[model samples]
Target: MPLTRVALLKGKSRAYRKAILDGVYKAMREAFDVPEGDLFMLIDEYKPSNFLYGETYLGIERDDDLVIIQITANNTRTTEKKKALYAKIVELLGEDPGIKPENIFINLVEVQKENWSFGNGIAQYG
Candidate 1:
């Protein structure tokens, strides 16, 4: 399971935001091999003054449309799979919301499966 947090500049339309969530979830299902109904995602909007980044970090020029996505999940995926997941997220988001490739930022936080407790004080995936 993956818990995704998406941060972007405020003032986007509801459809645009939904597209981001849908694109990320679709990519996780296709590339991360996430099971159906495992969706857990959040989106946070920040004002331009509050959101800051290097406009030309690593030779990639980012614009105001930049989106920052951070995902936390079990540390069970191989390196190759992780790469695929990132690529897929960009691809899907690009196709839907038309976000520029250079504007997409993703961070993955991996943890032991036992770290998650779905409900009732039980580590469901552990």
Candidate 2:
């Protein structure tokens, strides 16, 4: 399972936020091959003043609606899989929240599977 963190500007409606989460989860299932019950995610909304980012980073114009998604998962996926995941996320999110692909930024942090612990103070994956 992967832990997803979605960082975006505050003030979006509940439905809108849910759409974002749903879209990401769908993408993960399709591209990352995540199991049916493995869903785990969090949304961090920040005030405009605190949510800082470049408007034209890497020559890609971004706006207030920018979304920064970071996912922490096991380092078992190949580069091709990573690319597919990114594309699927952008596509799914675009269909739902209508977020521009340019504004959808994603980062993946892969670690060993042994680092995970489902609960009970047990390193289940280990």
Candidate 3:
């Protein structure tokens, strides 16, 4: 299971937002082996004044179009899978929303399977 959060500058069209979510879900499915229809994603749009980041960090040039994606998932994917997920996300977003590869930033929060509850007062994966 994975919970994803996407943060971006406000004022994007609804279609753009949908594309972002779809792109991420597709990437996770292909690279992370996420099950179908298991999406749990939230998108947060912030005003430029409220969102702050380095224009160029670690030699990566980021712009106002930058999207920060964070995912909390089971700590099971291999290094190759993680890298593939990142690349697939970039590719999908670039194809649809026209986001540059450099403008995409991703962070993974790994956790144990038993950490999830998924409702019913029970740990689904545990």
Candidate 4:
């Protein structure tokens, strides 16, 4: 099982967000051989002022886009899958939203089965 978490700065249309998520899931499923049912995706939206680039917030008056994706997996396959997914995301967003690839950051975390719970007090896959 794998979990992908995404966080983005505000101002993007719902359609844009959907496209990115769809691309990510597709890439993950194909690259990592993850079952669709085991894929968990979460998106968090935040205001531009909430995210900083340097000494200033992302976008002041204009639209500023920043995306962060975190992937949690149990092995090396997870890492490769996340790398592919992140590349796909960057490509999609760059083509459609005109966002620079440099603005996106991706992180991968490997953890033991005991670290997560799906529901009903039951642990997920080991």
Candidate 5:
């Protein structure tokens, strides 16, 4: 399972935000083979003053539409799959919310399966 966090500057419409969440989940399912009903995600809206970023970092030329995505998941994917996941996410989001690929920033944090405890104080994947 992947716990996804999407961060963006505030004031976007509800549909836009939901589209982002949906696009991310769809990308994970397609690229990572995530099971149905395994969705877990959240969005963080930041004020413009607090959501600071380099507008032209690495010459990508990001703007106010920049989206920051971070996902924490088990370290069970190959490098190729990881690359596919990023590409798929950008493709999906670009299609839906019309987010520019250059504005999408993704970070994946991998961990051992034993690191999670879904409930009842037990590591379900341990």
Candidate 6:
């Protein structure tokens, strides 16, 4: 299973958020060959005061778009997946929303199978 967490500075429209999610899911599916059922994506909206860039809070007086994406996966294929997914995210956002690549920050975390659970008391890969 692969878990993807995305955090963005507040103020984007709902359509923009949906575009981001759709782009991410498509990239994950293509890069990792992950089934839709094994993928999870979450979006976190933060207030201007909740995130900082240098001496200014994001989404306040600037157009700097701040995005942080974290991906956690169990397999070694995550390395390639991360690279492809990150690039795809940048491309999608840039083409769809006109967001620059420099404005995005993505993080990847690889974990063991024991670190995740699905439902009904069952682990993701168990």
lDDT of 4 by residue, 12-124 (tens): 78888887677667766766676777768888888766766542345433225657778787765645656776777677667765667766667878888787788888776
| Candidate 1 lDDT by residue in tens digits, 72-122 | 999999999999999999999999899999999999999999999988999
Q: Report the lDDT tens digits of candidate 6 across residue range 15-90.
A: 8887777777777787767787665788998998887664244543334486777778875674666688788878
Model 3 alpha-carbon drift over 4 Å, by segment: none
True-structure RMSD for candidate 2: 0.7
Candidate 5 residue-wise lDDT at 108: 98
Give the Cα RMSD of candidate 1.
0.7
**All candidates in order of lDDT, best leading:** 5, 3, 1, 2, 6, 4
Candidate 2 ranges beyond 4 A from true positions: none
lDDT per residue (tens digit) for residues 18-120 in model 2 = 9999999999999998999898899999998899999998999999999999999999999999999999999998999899999999999999989999899
Candidates' lDDT values, in order? 0.95, 0.94, 0.96, 0.71, 0.96, 0.74
Deviation from native of the Cα of residue 95 in model 3, angstroms: 0.2
Backbone collisions counted per model: 0, 0, 0, 0, 0, 0
Worst 10 residues of 3 by lDDT: 117-126
The TM-score of candidate 3 is: 0.98
Clashing pairs in 1: none
Alpha-carbon TM-score of each model against the true structure: 0.98, 0.98, 0.98, 0.73, 0.98, 0.81
Regions of candidate 4 where Cα sits further than 4 Å from its true position:
54-63, 76-82, 92-99
Q: How many residue pairs in model 3 have overlapping backbones? A: 0
Pairs in steric clash, model 4: none
